[model samples]
Target: MTAPRLLVLQPSQSDPLAKLGEWLEAEGVELHLVPLKEEPAPASLDGYQGVICLGGEMGALDDLEHPWLADARRLLSSAVSQSLPTLAICLGAQLLAVATGGQVRRGPQGPEVGVLLVAKRDAAGMDPLFADLPFTPDVLQFHSDEVHVLPPSAEHLAASPKYPNQAFRVGSSAYGLQFHIETTPEIVLNWAAKDPESAACARPTDFDLDFLAEAHRDFEEVWQPFVARFAKLVRGELSPAGCLGTQLPLV
Candidate 1:
């Protein structure tokens, strides 16, 4: 069978899907990255089976400064409306929220920037993608902005102490993750180097490469299966092993 192709929107040159790409490709999902910051948005979602928008430095509300954000919002809105399997990370999630009539602004609790645990909401047990996650899964939090309100159509999934919008599902197939599961050690190190204050506050002491590596290992262990399941959803295989043994058919 031909591999399923997914359109991956990369909004920033610096932040790309690092290890998450490996899991998807390993499962035979073809990734076609679109640099929205550098190029125009595609006319439609015609050829792709799914969409993935990665994290970036830009805010979702920065349409004036970054005009492509408007285009990204349109594409994401289309995906959610059409029920195309979609996953939006960080700023991408913020864009999806803003596109869907949800609200996004500076997180009042401040920037979440370390390995943290987010509790799965009871509603997550009913979600196809989130059902199998651990009760308190370790997730990387590194965003300054947060979603304040969700579209009425959105299903709340997970939450951290400070950020309640850690994970959510809009429609049946589209998802938004507030934290970073696709980051690699080098990526985290780069972010830490660039913004020393946030990173320092996130950790007990100074940044440690070895500890970051360990954290990445835990991240892979916890979230790679999540990505694998997402890839299966993109491929139209709702019943396969991933984080969840078999996805329940959506009603």
Candidate 2:
């Protein structure tokens, strides 16, 4: 059987796939990364079985400053409409929201940072990607903006105290995560150093090497298998029958 090929759109150089890539590759999924800043964004999803849009430092609405954002949004809209297996993280999540008739804005509750937990909504219990997750899963939050309103077609999945739209799904296979599951300690530290204001919003202990290290361990325990399952869904090893009776082809 051919390994499932996923197109990973990296909106920022700092936010590479990191541990998420390791986990997905371990599950036998092949990743092809496209750094939108350096290369042209693909106009179509012709050859890939899955798409993953990573976080970025820019706001989702800043299309004028970052022209690639417009292209990225178009691709996300296409992916969701086609029922392609897709995952959007952080800024990517906000982009997904806006691209699909949702809303995103500078978070009114301020930047949500640090290692935190998000509670799953009732609908998450039936979601293909979120169903198996713990009631409250560990995730890393570092964004200044939030997806305030989900798209018309989205099903709410998870929420934190400050952000109501932590995770959501559109169509049958596309998911948008408001938190970071692809970060490492080094990546967090780099984000902290670059954006001190957002870093200051976090608890003082959040930056401690020991504390961050332990948090990452907890994150791995919960999210590694979640990513593996996503890979399986992309490869057609699993079915999403519970999520509106949709089933992917077994490749």
Candidate 3:
């Protein structure tokens, strides 16, 4: 059988969707990454089994700065409308919420950084996407804005101490995660090197190479299992056994 085709909507070249790509490649999944900045209008979602939106520095409301955001939102809307299995991370999650009638706004204080814990609010009786995860799972995070509310029809999945609206599901197949589950040590280091501001915001006092290395190590351990879980969900698997077993039916 042919591997599932995943459509990756990327915002920029510098911040490539690293961890998601890594997970997909390891799972033997086929991916077609369409840089929205370059190609604003996506062709169709018919051939693809899932869509993965990567994190970006741009806000969901900043269409003037990054025009592609509008198009990306439209694509996400279409995907959700079709009930395609979709996953959004970080900025991508904010975009999904915005596109689905939810609101996205800046936090009252400032951006959230470093490794944090996300608790499953009411995911116990829900679908198997979050089946085996601990009630509260520690995950890496770096974002300024948050999803204030979920779409009327959406299901709240997880929350963090810092942000209550950490995750939600638009439909049975679509999910949005506020934390950066798709980040790897290499990717985080690359991002920190290119964007000094994010790095500074992350570690205000001691923003240096050594600090970044240490931070990367701390985050990697927290990020790995979440990435593995997300990969299982993408493959329509429920638990570790399901992930280890042959891939499940697409639906």
Flag clash pairs in model 2.
none
* Candidate with the larger lDDT of 1 and 3: 1
Model 1 lDDT tens row, 91-191: 98999898898999898877888888999998888676778888898877788999999866687889988989888888778889999899887887788
What's the true lDDT of residue 111 in model 1? Answer: 83
lDDT of 3 at 142: 77
lDDT by candidate, in order shown: 0.85, 0.91, 0.74
Candidate 2 whole-model C-alpha lDDT, 0 to 1:
0.91
Question: CA shift at 42, candidate 2, in angstroms?
Answer: 1.1
- Candidate 1 residue-wise lDDT at 96: 88
In candidate 2, residue 84 scores what lDDT? 82
TM-score of each: 0.92, 0.95, 0.81
Model 1 residue 151 distance off true place after TM-score fit, in angstroms: 1.5
- Please give the lDDT score at residue 182 for candidate 2: 87
TM-score computed on alpha carbons, candidate 1:
0.92
Model 1: residues >4 Å from true position, as ranges? 239-251
lDDT value, candidate 1, whole model: 0.85
